[model samples]
Structures are given as structure tokens and as C-alpha cells.
Target chain A: MQTTRTTPSRLAKRAHYDEATIHPILDEALFCTVSFAVDGQPMAIPTAFARKGNKLYIHGSVGSHFIRTIENGAPVCISVMLADGLVLAKSAFHHSVNYRSVVIFANAEKVTDEAECMEALALITDHLIPGRWDDLRPTTASEMRKTTVLVFSLAEASAKLRAGGPSDDPDDENRPTWAGVIPLQTVRQTPVPAPYNNDTPLPDYLINPQNT
Target chain B: MQTTRTTPSRLAKRAHYDEATIHPILDEALFCTVSFAVDGQPMAIPTAFARKGNKLYIHGSVGSHFIRTIENGAPVCISVMLADGLVLAKSAFHHSVNYRSVVIFANAEKVTDEAECMEALALITDHLIPGRWDDLRPTTASEMRKTTVLVFSLAEASAKLRAGGPSDDPDDENRPTWAGVIPLQTVRQTPVPAPYNNDTPLPDYLINPQNT
Candidate 1:
């Protein structure tokens, strides 16, 4: 989704609006720590999420305090960060990092329509693992009733990213200090069968990383 | 540090604590997003930090708006998160992540003593990359004048951690779907020499990960 001027805070800088740079980082992240105020107190809760198109969905228990507060139209801040590497610079002040992160500040609303909720659930399932929504049993009505799904339109969002190497000071260039980035990555491993699984064949999707 | 019961909200669940489970994860992490209110508006800033002896030190400009607010004894909520793996569950509701994170809610104060600030800075540098502080040039007086350091005692902190594979529904055990974790790691690579380095030798510390 395009970031508008109204929320310039959400705008992405440095190679701005490169879908190739944004989509993969957002899609690969599984947890987002949401920060918001409750009765004047600020609290952050880590929760699972699913993205569908440009909208991000987070589901929690209907009784969760965070869900209740957001349902009241309280402003919320949701952030997803991928720490790529540590940038060691010659100057302490210049020491930074190489990371890709997206922060969205929006008014969240609970999804009410059953059809929309189902679509959101499917989107979440597929977001977590591709090709799995059709392979497993669908969510029962009872389960959906107990869960509260909140939709955050990626309207006011900004992605601040730093990539490449260290920006050290010229004076310290001759200082015999190590300077480089420790590139970080996330990789899916072999699925661990449930304790009760009776040696069933591994799902084709699990066997093939490309499927995801 | 123990989380007291006076404010029950600060008392995290048992699963959130357990230093054995949380220390290594916290040490590996490089950044923390701190949230607080400024003039009734919420602001989250990403900053470098160092943890030593149950205290986390964050340094910034003395004139920084965030540091100014924190110096005034405003309630601060700091969160450090390390995403170990992405949990892809069978059901959307069950989908989660394997992560270790710590959240601290407390009052912060600016380090006023020059000696203490220097020691704290050393701790911060050592924490970021062990043995680097002694190897690099010391901070100049001008650098010290421009910097402000705030310490957050982890005494009131709560560590929350989740590890291992995904937790799926018992009924979905027989379903031919993939269920597992995608391991995530932060890896440091060879330092890229600055253009002005003119092919200087890489620091021994950077070449030896063990020193870090």
C-alpha cells in the first residue's frame, strides 16, 4: 500500500517504495509487538499475525485487554522488525545496524462479519505457511466465536531500512579494529512430527522449501 | 531481578521468566524499541543498548527529546526481542513464533557522574562487541558532552520466551499438513573495508567471532 503524506511518519526512506524490498521482509515476519495505551498506561503485547493483500490481521482472545482497548478505537502502534546485521563503524556515533522494519500506527477495528472473518483466517493460515489452508481441517464456528480478529489497514505505515556495510570515521580507519556486518537470516527447517504422529509421510510442502 | 507484585501487571507469567532460557537470547539481540508518552502522544525509538549486571544502559544525545522525557521520571516501557524461529501451525489461531523477549517498565534517570557515564559507556561498548572498547580509541571530551546515557534497572523487568516447534491442535495430528519452526539466526560476516581504508588489515576482533 502507498504511504500518504498525511502520515509522513509512515513513509519509507532510502530506496523508498521498493516492493521487492518490503514485501519479503513483511511476509517472512511471524510476530509483531503491538504497543498501545490503556487507561493512560502504555503496554506492548506480542501477538501472531496474518497479512492479506495490504491489510494485516491480528487475532486474540475476545477477552484480551488489548483487543478490547483497540476495539474502542484507541490508536495503536504495531511494529515488525527484521534485524539483518550489526554495523560496526570506526566512530562510536556512526555505529549503526543493517535492518528492515515497518511500523504502522492506525486505529484498529474488530472484524465482525463471519465471511470476512473466514477470509481473514484463511489469509492468516496461508501467511504462516503456504499451501496449508487446503491441507488441514477448517476452523469450526465455535473456535471463531471465541477469537477476536482485528484488522489494521496499512494506511499510515513507514519502513525504515539500513542495508550494506559500516559507515566508519576517517580518523579511526587506521585503528586496527574489526568492522563488518554479521548478516542474519531466517530459514525453515525439517518439520518435527507431533509426538502422536505414527510416522506418517512428511507433507510435500514441508519436504520442499520452495513450496513456501 | 525479580518482578514484584505491587503492580500485578508487571508480574509476568512464569513462562516469561527463567534466566537460563532468556539470557542467551537477550545477549544475542542488538536493539530494543522503547515506548513512552510524550505530550500525550506515543513515541517509539530504536536505540542501541548494553546489559550488565541486571541493568540495561541506553545512551543518546543529552538534548534528545526521548532522554529529556525519561529524565523527568516518566514511566518507560522497554522491550528487547529476539526472534528465534517462525512457528507455522496447522490452525491460524494456533500459529505463533519461537521467540525470547524481555519487557521492562520502570523509571529512568540520566547518568550525571562523568566516571559513571564513562564506565557505563565502556559496558555498553563491551556488550555490543566484547573486548572492542579497549581495542578502540577512547571517546573524546566533545563526544561525551554530546552524549546522554540512561540506565534501566532490570530489577522490575519480565522476560517472556517461547521456543521449540509449533503447538498444534490434537485433532489435527493426523492431518497431512506441515507443522514446524523455521529457525532464525543472526550471523556476522567479514567487515567491508571503508573506501578510505585503502586495504587496511581487518581487525583481529572482527576476524575472531569468539572475541565478540
Candidate 2:
């Protein structure tokens, strides 16, 4: 697959592009804001996605409008953003945020082959929680029939990111207002047992903080 | 102002019509994903926003492409979502999220009057951080001239929300996979002093967790 990089604009400075910076941000994200046109109107849909190598996979019910739109070979813009902190600045105009985000602009195509569809579904499952495919119950035929998986090659993608403390005006430093970064984070808490469980030990993947 | 509510779809399960849910979510959010069409191409741009009593305000440079498109009176969809957790389920097909979000569909109008322009800026600042307007230096004339603010009356908005734990299939309850929510939150850490600071105490609002 060909790899294309898009430069970060002034507004997109809060977005990052390096592989090291992009992968972690994409991996940590659970949902993406997808924008596409439907009947001459712009529509933004929040959907779950998985990134495998250079391809991004998004799945939904076959009847879903978003899937249908992409099935027709429409270009879609998918964006995933993790808001790390609220940058409280000295000035209103200068106030900003510390966030890491990745945007993929691609022409999505529907995965039609049964084998490829199952693989994409497994990839999505593994992306959400590693080792989930082997551990969880397998999908039934009906489940697969109902699902529509769209795969977009991330060849024309760019990751833009901003981190660290606030960028305040030099002259406003002495102002009494607080000017700094409030670092935000997403942490996985202790898992609650399934109501019908027989008190099985939690998996190492779920209990281990490092795995998260 | 006129008050109207848009019906919620399955994609908008967490939206509420009551003020209790709508007002708080709108007030706490700092930015929104503005989706609009430019040259028949759909784009979603993240920008800072402020909410007044019944209207939401967003401002950017007059030369910004986003502003230029919205100023032409195109229909826009502005959305803010707070993902509360990852709803880990027993099956990959059933996995979803618990989130609180508000999506507003309205025709945007550019704010032109000087008095309304100043009010919108101040409202945005105060929404970002309560009591911040009095603490920081005011916007200069040059700053005002460079910025273009747009106001969208929140009257035509709807809030969709989803809360609580995972919704796993009953048959898969006995599966060994751990099933529950990994709660996500946006927390503010202690502010870091600006490089040029003279070691002044952080403002009371900055230290207040509620301000976030």
C-alpha cells in the first residue's frame, strides 16, 4: 500500500503525524467521528473502528445508512481524537487544548468475501481487547450475515497531535489567572464480574494494568 | 428565540430533552465538531465554543475556511460527545459504548454587531473557565478584527445519552471472558506554571475540580 502524509495546518497543530505518536493514539481510541455525504447532506456518525496494519475497519448492521453509503464507494473521512487535557490559558483567544488525533481520508470499500469478512471482524475484536477472539464465543452465521464491514486503506492518512503544557502569551505571564495544562487520562478500572459467572479468576489481560 | 427539539435516532440514544442534561453538557464542553459542506465536500472541524443562555458561540479567524463556509448560511451539524466507558461485552458483535452526547442541527448565522461580538467572546471565555473573564486581559481591537464569531441558537438541538453497564447476550453470560465497563473520564491535573511566571499562586478556579 502506498503511504501518503499530509502536513499539519495551524489549526491542526494539536494533531501529530509520526508513527510513534499516531499508533498509540489510534490504539487507545474506541470510537471515531466519521463524516460523509448522504443525499447531498453532510452527516457525521460516531462508530467503532479497528486499525490493522495500514487498513482501518469499521463494521455495523448491513441496513445501516453509513455502511450503505460507503458500500456505494463514497470517500469517507474518519477522525479519532483523544483529549489529553484542557489547556487553561491566560487569554481567551490564546486558550487551547492538548490533544492527540488521527484523521484518515480514504475511499472505503465493502468487504464481500466471507473469509475476508470474518478476518476483519476478528481484527476488530482483537483491536478492542487483545486475545478476545480466542477467549470469547465465536460469532454465529446469523451474526455475520447481519454485519457489514467496511475496510479503508490508511494510505492517505495523517496523524496530527499536540501534547505538553499550555502555550501562553509571554506578556500575559504575570496575570493572576492560572495558565497551565490539566493532563487527562483514560484508565481501566477493576473489572466487575459477570452476574452469571461461577467466580472464575479474571484473565491476566483484564487485570494487568500494563496490558491496557 | 424559538425552541424546537429534533427527534433522536438509534445513533443518538443518549440525548435528553430536559434542561438538566442539556444545559450541563453544553456548558462543560470546550469544543465541538462542526460538520458542514464546503464546495460540496463535507468536513468536520473541531473548534472552541461557548454557550450563553440559549445560544452557542464559536469564533475563528475571518480568513479561516470553516468560518467562510458557515458564514454563507449553510446548514451545519455541531456535536459534542463525552465517552464515559468502554462497554466490554461477551461477544464482539455486541460491544458498544456508554456515552453522553449532544448534537445540534441548525443554520448558523454570523455575528456582525460589535456589541453582540464582544458578548459572544466573553461568553465563550466564561464557558471555558468560569470567572475567567474578570481575571484575564480583555480582547484587543486587532484581535477582534481578526476573528469572526458565529452564533447558533441552541433551540434546535437534541441531547442523546447512554449510561450504565454492558448489554451482553444472555446466552454468553457464562463465557469466561470478563465483561464490564472500563470507565473513562476527563480529569484535570495541577496546573504547570508558565515559563515566565513570577511564582504567583494558581487561581482558585484552576484549582477547583468543578471548573473542569
Candidate 3:
């Protein structure tokens, strides 16, 4: 859905509107920046998020300012970016980054229903760690009361991305400079167990998430 | 510089108002998300940025909607977040992330002076890969015209960070679930040479950036 607000005015070729291109980028990243205006001034805060079907969920302590400010159905922009690599070109002006980014525009609404809130909370937990939610103790009513859950539809969203080697001008290609991409990868390191652990073996999901 | 807007109302212990706490986080990250309102609707874009002294710089083609909209000295919110790890707790409500984040509210101004623009461009290039800027072909006047650079002051900025393992409740600490930190690290992969490379040796700056 390329609404008037979702389209990019420049470099239009890089913009994408279909869910095939947008949904994976949303699911892959662990967090996103939520942008909105309070009294005509803009503010952006980074928080963990999860995608459940066509809706995105984010939660925080009810007392947090970001949660309180945007829970009233304010227009918000949510952005997620995965930096792939640094694109080095023969010319200084051509230096760019290889990245996949999605920006979504929507009005956020609070989730007041208990079942939906619980499902959203579980979805968020499973989104971060595939099977960890059920393994942990069930959420108590007190914990549910202390948190605020906000939801936004992925109906009006767009993704823009750049990949591969540098696109240098023919004239600059022969220059005596090294040009290419230095790839960046985010890897999960060895997990550090908590001091009070009762020696529970590290879960296989944490070790082999791709299989999950 | 803890203005009403920059201050967080909850979990106040994590907030820091001084440059000693903010500047390093800004420098270590390669980019930030710029947030602003257009026609009363909020928009957020992720772009590469560099910090020089008390100012942060970002640029794009002059034809881009983001550049055209913000070049008029609009009020903007810039946010940088470095996700450290996933903090898994015994209770679902206690699960959180270890991260260092900084948010700044400032008015953006277009760089009109040629000297300052060139300096900012070079600073951004070097900021991404130290010593690579000087090796590339110099920027042409035409190239400068095609670019739009925006700057924001570091004043009115604050940083909030959380590190270490999960903080679970005393009652849940004895639960039979594994709790810990799954550290996330971004590492550079092998560089891929462009198709037209003249067999130029990969520079030390690219291979050993920490030494640079």
C-alpha cells in the first residue's frame, strides 16, 4: 500500500511496498525506533518489538514516558535498519552503506483486552527467543497490570535497501584505490549464566536458533 | 542539559546528562535515526552520521524528501542505540535488553559554506573508515551541489544504558529456568573487491581499524 506518505521522493527505485520485501526485515530485527510528536515536537525512542501477523507489538513499563505519551493513538513512525556492510567506492561522493531499512507510518493504540495483551506479550517473548516464553514461569496478573502494550498495523509501510559492490563511475573505476564492501555480521556470543542458576542446561533454542 | 523533554520520567537512575556519558556512545555507532514531523505527521529515517566536536552531521542527495523537508531548520530528534545483549530472566516480565542509547533534540540547519561542507563530508568518510577519505578521488563541485548536509548540536542530549545480567525477582530466582545474557557482537567480515579493482592491496585501515 503505497499511500502518499509512504512513497519516497528520491531514489524511487530502491523503495518497496510489498509484504514479501517488508515483513522479513521487520521480523529479523530485534528492536525498532518509534517516532512521534508531542506538542508539535518530534521524539524517537528505541524499544524491542515483535511482529504478529499484520500487527507489530511493543511494550514498556506503564510509568515510562514513551509508553504514556504514545498510548493514546498518536501518529507514529517506526523504523528498523540492518546495516549489511560499508560500500567503498573509487570516488568520495559514491561512498555508501549496504543496508535494509523499513519505515512504517501508523497510529498506535493501546491493547486493553486481557487475552490479546497476554498473546501479544507471549508473541514478543517468542519473537526474541523462539521457545523461551513457554519455558519461563507464566506471567502474573500483577506483571500484566504494570506493563503497557501498544499495537500498530503494518498496513502503510515501505522498505528501502541497497546491496552488493560499489557502483562507481566508469572514469573512476580505473583509479588506484581499493573499492568494495566490508561486510558486517551480528553474532550471538556465548551465553553467561546468572549466578543463582540451579545449573539448568543451556536450551538448544539459544544455541541453534536457525533450526527453530 | 536535562531539559524537560530530554529527561526520562521513569527509571531515572539510568539517565546521564553529561558529555562524558553521551559523546562516546555517539562516536562508537556508525549511524543514527533522525525523527521529525512533516505536515504534523511524524517520520523517522535511518541514515549514516558522524560527530565532529559538538555537532552531528548527516547528508543525502538534495532531491530526497528527507533532505528537502529538514533543510529548513526543522526541530528534529536524533537517536543512536547500540544493543549489547539479551537479558533473559526467570520471569517473563523481567526480560530486557542490555544497550547503550543516546537521544538528542535539536534544530537542523543546512550547511551553506563550502569549506564547512567539505570538512563535514570528509569527517563523515573518515568516521566510517579512518584514512579512506584521503585515498579517494577529491570531491568535485558538481558532486557537492548534488548533496545536502544537515547538522545538529549535541546540546539538549541525554544517554541511558543498561548492562550486565538479568535482574529477576527474589521469588523467581530459584526457578528451574536458565537466565543470562546472550551477548551480541557486530564483527567485520572479509572485504570483497570490486569487479574493476586494479589489484590494489587492501589498506591497513580496513584490516586493522582499531590501530588506526
For every model in order, the fraction of real contacts preserved is 0.30, 0.51, 0.93
Model 3: residues >4 Å from true position, as ranges? A208-212, B209-212
Candidate 1 segments whose C-alpha is farther than 4 A from its true place: A1-25, A208-212, B1-24, B165-168, B208-212
- Which candidate has the highest lDDT of all? 3
- lDDT against the true structure, each candidate: 0.69, 0.73, 0.88
Chain B TM-score of all predictions, in order?
Answer: 0.87, 0.89, 0.96
What tens-digit string does per-residue lDDT give for candidate 1 at A113-206?
9998888777776776676677767788888998888898776666678888776666777666656565554455556654544565667666
- Rank ordering of all candidates by DockQ, starting from the highest: 3, 2, 1
Best by DockQ: 3
Kindly list the per-residue Cα lDDT of model 1 for residues B1-212, writing each as its tens digit. 45442133421353455556555655777778887765444556667787776777889777666687677668777877876666766666676767777777877877889998988888777677776677667788898998988887776676776777667778776665656666655555445655555656666566654312
lDDT of 2 by residue, A48-123 (tens): 7888777888888887766877776786677777777777677777777677777777778889998888988888
**Candidate 3, A80-164: lDDT as tens digits:** 9988899999998888899999999998899999999998999889887788888988899999999999999999999999999
For model 2, the docking class works out as medium
Question: Order the candidates by lDDT, highest first — what do you get?
Answer: 3, 2, 1
Ranking 2 against 3 by DockQ, winner: 3
What TM-scores does chain A show, candidate by candidate in order? 0.86, 0.86, 0.96
Estimate the TM-score of every prediction. 0.85, 0.88, 0.97
> Model 3: what TM-score?
0.97
- Taking the tens digit of each residue's C-alpha lDDT, what string does model 2 give over B32-56? 7888765555667777788877788
